[model samples]
Target chain A: MTSFGNEPLFLGIDGGGSKCRAVLYRKDSGIIGEGLAGPANPVQGLERAQDAVLACASAALSDAGLSQSQLGHLIVGAGLAGVNAPRTRAAMLSWQHPFAQFYLTTDLHIASLGAHDGTDGAVIITGTGSSGFSQCAGQQRFLGGHGFPLGDKAGGAWLGLAAVQAALLALDNLGPATSLSQAVLAKTHSQDSTALMDQFCGQPSAPYGQLAALVFDEAAKGDAVAKAIVADGAGYLSNMVLQLTELGPIKVAFIGGLGGIWQPWLSDAAKARITPALQGPEVGAVIYAQQRYTGEHAP
Target chain B: MTSFGNEPLFLGIDGGGSKCRAVLYRKDSGIIGEGLAGPANPVQGLERAQDAVLACASAALSDAGLSQSQLGHLIVGAGLAGVNAPRTRAAMLSWQHPFAQFYLTTDLHIASLGAHDGTDGAVIITGTGSSGFSQCAGQQRFLGGHGFPLGDKAGGAWLGLAAVQAALLALDNLGPATSLSQAVLAKTHSQDSTALMDQFCGQPSAPYGQLAALVFDEAAKGDAVAKAIVADGAGYLSNMVLQLTELGPIKVAFIGGLGGIWQPWLSDAAKARITPALQGPEVGAVIYAQQRYTGEHAP
Candidate 1:
């Protein structure tokens, strides 16, 4: 459990649009500490995200029983939410940490690193936000996730939005008939369809994304509409990976909230969209821990 | 123009998995008499569908003074592509007519009907093959087309049997990722990552599903480990509809090669997945011509 326990201990963090995940691992690649915390808004603002990271890091430190100053060196890998902006990117680079070294990157990069075991591969992430990223020959790239208006096509948010639309169609009599109508109505506990409209048109977008799981549940039970939602998501997501890989060779992988969530509702084609890496994103995180540690001090 | 004028008229037909639409109106609905066409299977089984009722009764026919009995009705709204066990349902229907009806169904029901009018609604056909149907509600229904192994999902012959199991992980070095992988590779151009052991893997699956587009293109794109192909198809198609609805309130329709194409693709939050009406299937064919004759009568 000590940093000097025959080998160094490294920290790998995956921070992105929605949530941030961090795991403490041995240089030899064993998990020692793991911590999960609130959503760290990296793009929108950094103050909140910094606080989240501090809280998560503190928790991990406590779990590992090591003081920050006692660590020999630390490798921090973060795939942040909105680091796409210059200001955000600069802010990430400017953050001076107590650790010896840290690397901040887009969430997709870390996710891919974790999934591919650090080789050239791609990862399609579907969650509150959705995107696909590929890293080949030690370089990174991506597709989709421009924004809710422009991208984020096949994320959980997308699923939720489809559910809302289906619910509304059932309400207006202008859409395909689906059981998703009843389920949506039940979500609000609304006695009528009119009330359902208020829920969707009534609220802003971020809140609406919360309803995606409802569609997933409905699809799990064989609702054609709901299944369509997931299927469509699979199509969009897989296409992104395909497009990203257009750059070079790819051994693809799925790594995200929606990546592993498709077990119950995955269709035959979705399973064929990307090459499943032997390890999930979490495992990717551990691999990242080892890679970053080695990369920093490769003899 | 009088019926005795002896001039052939242009006809619009929409054939889908659910229903067929035939619209024949000569610039007016007052004389618009609609005729039913049994399913037209010129594509699937070539020139005839088993269950298809190829009835061709145009609203113009009722207006035509010549009720010629020498020729039977010409049906156009059957989704042929060698549809499953054709004539199973067509044999049950009665076809009584004195004129020939030109067939016009291409599995792109809404687009052919709605696209020409400027309404852009996308359709994914999945009978024997699949296509993307787009109709911009009240604007145009432009079709992206149903390209094999790329554009379709979840229906027809390909999906039902492609990945029965072992789809979750396409373990190349790990021994056949999943049954889904084996199924896809066997049915696809490439039989899994390492090269197919069987030379005749694609025997049963002749006209590959649109999911193949993801695979074939992904392979071209270097997603050799791709297992998310199906999910991508479904998600992207759904997003296409989302984009359609984003344009405006739509007559989002789904009638094509497969009953489950849009479901898998429409998983995006931005998508507007519509459940269509149960009214006459080929009613669009009549409506197509009707809308042309009268501004009203088209979705």
Candidate 2:
């Protein structure tokens, strides 16, 4: 049998479209190390994520003074890029990794686990993408956020995409004039649609999601356009929660940028519609690592 | 070089999930034919739609007294079950029959075209499913509606799916006490959740969308839960419109069962953001047919 590492650290990761993170737990079940890096989207294109995951993991591992062979039962529960899809899954599964006993899944699933402290609950994850997942009696179900150009309505990408449309509409004098143009202009320092196009097209890596926040902020300040988006996003989320809870009793949690913005206004609404138990993915990862790696009673 | 049908009989057909139609065009260059059928999901299990199309077209043709060869050009455009995607595109393209020339596209694309004569416009088709499409400057773009389990957020299926959840939530006392219980009771003619469950689980022909409509109608009459759903649906449509207009100046049009119900209330607000264009697929097909079979008249 394999032995534990030098003081052996268990690991968990929340690998997302924009970022990937790793959190280390102690042999005795306490938090030890943490590291963050750029996107590890193992499905779309795995090279970057593979390199990044390995490098990030090593950075965290190096910080903990442990080598790959030193660990026992790594139990890396990753929220991978395309876990719901077999092609993505197959690609990710084929990722050239040397991990020992690695467990991979969607980021939303891990967020669900993290949000409910590894218990029965549902989580709506909205980043560049959006997804809803629930677990009860060890059964899991997912709703929405299929992929880009098709699904993932009411997420950061959805909001960002809306902002782009609003900008285009205003440029063409198609819709009611709004400040989105100014916000995008300021964001890109561009004079007209041509410059804006360059930023989206040419790219020093423009943050497409940056505009989603502007829309939310503008909506909060009473722009009808923005208000429509918030109202729509809440509905998208509510719809997701409704589907997730179809299985059985459970709490609900929100994760991602839009969640952070809508949380206060939505808290009461959520209480009426969902159960109360909730938390975050980072904390959830810690708890998961403890239960799966360090013995439950290990001190 | 081609002769027109003397009776001025024209037919317009909109086929997809939840509703399918064969409306004859009778007025000079306008719609006159009319027939409705079941789900003609081309991506679904079989060849029923091809037969349905031929039968319905024949019926319309008979009504008009237009022989096959004498007809100017029987331009047939279809947005069927399997046409929304790239993989299905080849299959859809290959389904040509004798019609001078036939055009096949996604129900989403054709619906958008039908709504506004295939101009730069968008359509939120919310029948048994929901999807959005926008075409501008001779290019097509799509958003939402990946599939059923991955249903577009804020759609008929989403609404139908949400109503079921609310009813279930009330069953376990996990949510507010609402009339959904009574609504469920009224639909299945059962007193409690058990009877409803029997229908819900029975043979899968319960028309779950019917329950979603009850939620919308009650909301119109001031039911709290129902009102939320109506506003929620309106909000989602707004977001979809925004995304569709991303390509360029787009006049959005709504279609499908839930779209019809919600269109009136949503019109002013929707028009505020999108230039709401009125027309449907039948009109679009005629317009597309004119361009394809005869000379360039601009679509």
Candidate 3:
């Protein structure tokens, strides 16, 4: 066993809209413990995010058989959602963390790093929201993480919104009735258009994301409306991939809940650039910490 | 001047998402007074809507040189937005109103009544939201009006959302840059995609509805993206008109802020069935009160 004074311990955190994850690690032994907690997106709630970050970090220390007092002895690196906004970033940077050292970055940056195992590459994320990010020759580019109703085309929430729109049109007899519409009605437990509208009225993107699977399933079964919706979303993602590729020769890795599902629908050129992710964003956070620490401590 | 006791005073109220309008009427004097107040949609706030209703009514009485106590003698007919929702309707119905008799119905219903001067007809409304309503042969039919994001296609908010989506795509280099995109960026004071996204993040339908005029202006200037957006929305509105016409031989009257802007884009078939509205929704509420009072007193 490495003594506390002889070897430094690291904690890596990946925080997002729905949940926060932390991994405790050592250079010699790799991952020693893992932790999970609720939402940690600063844009949603700065106080809640801070609480979640501390909770996950504490859980990670406990998981590694360490005491909470050891927080001051450990270095921490965090990749958090919504930190791309300058205000949110500033707010997060002001957190009075309990770590010996703490580093922060946007979730997309860490995600790209993790996809390429701390090397330069591109990543397309299609979870509840959609976005593309790349780092090549120390230059970074970001595209299409605009959120639901305004942007985020090809993301889960976008797909769900498209499905609901089509289903409603069909129900109103303004558009053709299809199996996709039927499935949407069934999945939402809505007997008619009014009920379906009631289900989504003034709702956020999460609930819409939950309905995404219905689109893929119906499209796979040859529903024209579903196929059209999928094609439109996939087309946008494919264009995003092409746009990202223009930045550098970096291989692109797809990540997030709907990432794998979108693979088959991408253009041949987009598919050609696809690669498997080497690690998760938590590992990317650790890599970020190591790089920052080395650069700051260099002679 | 008709004495209040000799000629019963009738108050008609048209309460919508943004404002409430009241008209004081009598058979001998016609419209004698008018009043207006803000945001009276019960779905947004029951208490606020109730207060606005009373405020508008009090203003109408004051305009007509009547005391506040005269409310107890005035028969009121109200056509309110959001009363279509059963729960909101029930809550509104439960209010201990000060009027002698209060009859409540949906804004769409009153609009249709006023458009046809209490005769049977169909009406299409395209404001911040969209909907179609027709009353013919003692049967009523309603369409669209599902609200923003989920539905409300062809409405101001829907048109604005489509424009923003196109603008973001153009900014990201995934779609062609056009005058529509340029206008959106300029109107929102956004320098780039990030800034544009920031401007609309978590915004409600009202802000988006404000952008509708941009689409119309760009489309008029022959911008392809804007034209396409307008075409899609106009197609939906035309389809809505066709669907409403299927119910009966009723002439359809287009109403609301964007109603006239959408006229030139509608199909010839839709255009053939269009007619000018004879009166506003507040007058429809008066007609409703007259019908109800006459029916009750007839035997």
Candidate 4:
């Protein structure tokens, strides 16, 4: 009935901190349909991530002009955020997903695959969080991306956090009173240190990530503290990029919301090895499904 | 009726991150009994804090050989952690407490009160958390103690967090590898960065605070990174002490579990300003109750 006989439908999903993206594909027709949903990182919430995956899958099927029952006919590849944690990965693996076949991996892995278009390469993601992954010579290496507060250096959340820290120290007269501090105070609409601190107490990284742009804005205006923060972050990313490059002569693709902003700040050597991503992570997920499915069914 | 003519029994409570402490006192007999209970920081949990307060109060009454119904006869003073946040304070104040009268203030306030023996002075608390409070010339000033991952420099949690960050950087080869990193890995039983990060993910400040001694231990052995961390924290505290002293000619007392460990690290000027607290915070709570009660009943 389909364009090609005995060809299976492939569903690729990229689940991240804020949203989940899905693509329904067939070998004969490329991507037939796509769908989107919200907050599918298992580290944030396991049940919520699972629900988003199923919902996006169904939506993708519907968008492809197919019935919901076609979900069971689709082979799926999912790249989810927070699955690197052993416990989170286990919880996800226990999921009774609705699909003919399922393959799961880290969001970084999918991003890398898609960046190089299923070839060997490295990807540096600088969104709400930061991390690097490289697959070369049949080996994979992970760098940075330890999560917020503990790590995730050069990330949006880290930039915002550094700005807040500088502001608080200046407010207490323990650190220099820079324009960056004033900028942070103005951005948060906080009249004083107490108000500023209160706004961020017990908060997750998303709220901090929201403040990251302020740091860059102030730095561009030649704020010393802001510049220092940016330099430190960029230095970390440069080091990460260099380390990822050590896994061979693989091209490193800087991707994510803040990726473009960080590009110029990298070292000249790091910049030299940079390349544009071939496709989005959602497409990488599909490639993952196809590879795994073929590997399993091979003679 | 009880001892001195018509004098009421005073119950003083110091509610903190890990435990609640209570002291029962009377005009004729000072500190007749004391009791301790579990964690009572309202920022951590509202109902749990309330329950800990009640439990500690009940235990104090029992220790003083009084019946549970005696809860209604005692005037209470509670100095709780996190009450500096208006929301946490409002929630705590709304408790339907079983006491003849309830007086509430921040733990820092009572610490300052008790440290100076109800006189004008300053107190810096460096424990599982950190804060500075000074009462002088009919005015009160609050400093630092912004809570973990935000502020609280020189606090145990801050020290531990800095160590972890250093260790992670070293493991990633982004920073110089020091004995501090080796010690942290051994302490956490982690073979690499992933395990170290895993142990601290989504963890509260208390767990990090537990690792603080490792920093001090390594610093004592002349580890450059550990020493730098200590110096940075001490510098912040030194500045805080100088600011508190600027309020007036006030004696500053370093208080809390880690207070003594940090004392020798402070600047000579900060050291010169330091004095020993005359009493613990629980006793300070009683002083707070008496001061409030006398003020209310006067004229």
Candidate 5:
């Protein structure tokens, strides 16, 4: 394989629990190709994640009309879920790769960098789980990304779990009856808590998280229980964002599948601080790769 | 297979999720023999539950100096968990048995009867789950006992889940920090919500319910979060009991492993209506068997 005369080809990858995406770029040519593949999170398995990344990159290469041997001329950066763990990161870093150079970081980290043009800022992610990160003055403060039943107060799983709990309370007439309870009962085909528990307890976190969208829908229609849950969740997120401001006047971006759904619920002060992200995590990966590759070449 | 003419031999069995207990009695004598076996809840498996009940009864017979051949001389009554489900009850009723006569009822049904001396009264079972039953004026009213994450407001699982949720909020500085959070973190050896969620989410309801004792213990020592959880639970139970009173002035007994633990938290009005149980579900099973056998004999 020969270097393409310092044309500086780049492959940027964003790998998450749901999917892996790659964007291939050439300096001054912008994005030349893009590819998509199945889930590539490390928790799924090192081999599976690697295969996903390779397949996505290969597709991007094909899209760019490039050959396999050209891989040796490319700089690569990956922002992936479950890469925050030391063991996972170390394993990926040590793995054999054909790229000219490789850069690795968390999906959250890349999203934050991209949100603020690679400068200091904060981001709150409320997808299947919830968490927030604020970087300022060369220091970072993290909050609320703990996962379901722990810190994901306003996250999808938390919302669904809380909704189920409330529905049970309503069924017993221990709390006010609401339409939210009826909806859950209908979905589960359960007339009471015993049926509901027997059916739902054995399921993993995803089914519970899926119910969160229904809750938000009910809240929009003026269901008291759903409204209360949404308000409580919003309160938690608002407090988190307000605390981010204490570190510095950094722009805060809400980023995640559920982030846009919750945007209207955030406090006015928090909403005022919010800014649109300039690009997706994949673009962030590209920018990150460019910066790191340039720094190495400068010296 | 011959009868012990005019001599009544009684076997009362209480089958629950954890274990099965059998007591043998001769008409003129009090408890003459006792035996124990493993969990006999039919939900676990009809075969396994049946085997547990048989093993427990056989042990009691051995203690009473009876051979397997003497099974035909005994009249057996069982109050078993999962028998409340019609399918389980019908299956057990239809199964072959060697006893001279056999009667079946739910653990909750017999618990109510035993607690109130075979008379009209009520019982709220607050063990790993919560459920209430009131039998008065020849009618029965059932409430709450929906199992974890659905019902069981003041039940162990609910308390533990609430404690974990609180600990995460405390960790995020979104809520008051308390000793309960410290205790949970210490027990799970989890430093953050992510670690805690990964550890706790996979576990079944029992482990979560077990942590409830810790929450109550913390509340006793004045942990604000613990106190709030306990109070919220008590509020739910209070509402349940008050609704039960709407039927009439019936005596109420709290039953099960965790029943006594929550007694002190009952409201004064609720406490005033409370009464000590006359006997346990096993004894109630014996009494029920005697009544049925005598009624059969008369005609």
Candidate 6:
């Protein structure tokens, strides 16, 4: 575990909309330290994202009992949330950094890397948003990452919205009453459908998306409406997987906050094919750095 | 068409988000004049809406060869877009106007009134939003009508969004490439899925909803993806109508800009039950005023 041999250090940063996390590691010593900070999604705010990145990296170095002078020995990889936005990604890449070398890519790409140990595989993300990413023989393909209310059919936001719609319909006597609807009605603090519509129509997609977990929980208890939503979500995911498999017979992984909830509802074929990730996206970011820069064999 | 008899005049106004229309009528002369003005949706701007309403009314008066002072002889009925919003309705009702009497109701309510001739029937409004409203033996039952992105499943915005999603998937080689996708890509000025997503995700629901007509047009041309989207939209509409009919067997009328677009795709049962509106929402407004303010029988 000694670093006196001038061993090279690696840093991986996973910067999402809500928070940023960094991992510092070495081949022999393994993970030496980790740091976390607020959102570092450059599309939201480049300055804020940069600040989070610097703070997390510095904190990680401090936890590893290192100083700014030691930055020269570290190579960094950042898998960021908004790296798909060209302007944001370009701006982020041009910023001055303390690391010896830096590689930047999307959070989805790194998640795929970590899930398959930097090999050819696919990962379906079904948290607040829904998307699929796959890498096969160095060629990458993306699917279904559209944001809430438009796409992300099986994502948290979509589930929550469906729950609210079901509740409203039940209240209107257009659909059967279910616990999921009742729960959503209560959660939105509306006594009736009209009140809920007035309130819900004014809010953004995030709050409804936050209610997706509640929908899943209610479905697990056998609420018919909830089950229907879950089934629909699972069907969308299955379609994504089926579409991805057409490229090649690649192993697939499920990732994101809502990942586990979708498993029970997935098709038997998808169930047999889906595999757990080897590690988190941060480790994937580190692995990406190692592969793209260090030329070191996967650990 | 002479006003020499000093017969009372009626003005029916349909004020929506994009435009305001008014028709001036006399008991003996029928509709004497019509006028159009800018949007008067109070939810968007109370002042602007008030202006549009007033301007349209004034223009109608002028077209009818009447003067502003003649407003004292006129009764007004306004079927407005945001009359369902309590604040907007209340504010509009409280405004000072020259009309001898004023009746305010939702555009949907007026549309229903016009479709059913103020009888026991139903109307499904499918444009930017989708909703079913029925009056059965004086008991009003409202279904769907959830605004864009959350509820309006079969509406324009929903169709456009589904089209975009299909286009992106097709571009990704996850689905069959179709004319709908190519047109959408060209319309959005996007070279590929990445650019399309980057562009599409930034726009609001209105623009997407506007694209819905294109989907219907493509569906008419036998595009596979477009046909699928149309089928799905029709299915949602059918479900809405079927749910509405559970209360009672009644004729249903479809209204809105995209209203007629759905007719060919409706189920045979729905087609059998569907009927045309005898008049427009403005006439419905006028009829509403006559029914509520005067002792006139529905005509």
User: Largest DockQ belongs to which candidate?
Assistant: 3
Residues B1-299 of candidate 2 have per-residue lDDT tens digits of 23474433334455665456665554455554455666666655336666666666766665555554533345565556556545556755676565555666666666676677656677777765566778889888666554432234456655665665556545534345677656756765766444444455312222565676777767767767766766766766676677677778767777766666767656364656444446667566555554454453244
- What is the C-alpha DockQ of each candidate? 0.01, 0.03, 0.80, 0.60, 0.50, 0.33
Best by TM-score: 3
In terms of TM-score, which candidate is stronger, 1 or 4?
A: 4
Question: How many steric clashes does model 5 contain?
Answer: 4
Please write out the lDDT profile of model 6 over residues B1-299, one tens digit for every residue: 33534666788888887899999977777888888999988988988988998899889988988777777777888888867767778998898877787778888777878787777778898887788877777677777766666577788888888888888767766568999999898788889867877766756668888788889989999999899889978877876777666668777899987889899998887788788987898888777776776664345
lDDT of 5 by residue, A82-161 (tens): 77767789988887978888898888777888788788888888888888887888787777665555457898988888
Model 3: per-residue lDDT, tens digit, B15-59? 998899999997888998899999889988999999999999999
Candidate 4 Cα outliers beyond 4 Å, as residue runs? A1-4, A42-51, A67-73, A84-100, A293-299, B1-5, B38-55, B66-75, B84-101, B292-299
DockQ of 2: 0.03
lDDT of 5 by residue, B149-209 (tens): 6567788877888888888878878778889999999887888766776777656678788
True-contact fraction in model 5 equals 0.57
TM-score of 3: 0.97
Residue lDDT tens for model 4, B183-288: 9999999999889988998788898998889999999899999999999999999999999988899989999989889988999999999999999999999999
Docking class of 6: acceptable
Query: Between prediction 1 and prediction 5, which has the larger DockQ?
Result: 5
> After superposition, which runs of candidate 1 have C-alpha atoms over 4 Å from their true positions?
A1-7, A202-207, A216-224, A227-231, A260-270, A277-286, A289-293, B1-299
CAPRI band of model 4? medium
| Residue B52 local lDDT, model 4 | 94
* Lowest lDDT block of 10, candidate 6 chain A: A1-10
Q: Which 10 consecutive residues of model 3 chain A have the lowest summed lDDT? A: A1-10
TM-score of 2: 0.48
Ranking 1 against 3 by lDDT, winner: 3
Segments in model 2 whose C-alpha atoms lie over 4 Å from true places? A1-8, A67-73, A94-97, A201-206, A264-283, A286-299, B1-299
Per-residue lDDT of B1-299 in model 1, one digit per residue for the tens? 33523333434454443344445444443224444445554333323432343344333244353353312432333322322223433432334423344333334553434433423444444455444444553443333322222223334433433332123223222124534465455554563322331222233344433344444333334443433545544554565556455545554555554443345345545344565533333344544443443443245
Residue B141 of model 1, lDDT score: 35
- Candidate that beats the other on lDDT, 1 or 4, i.e. the better one: 4
- The order of the candidates by DockQ, greatest first, is 3, 4, 5, 6, 2, 1
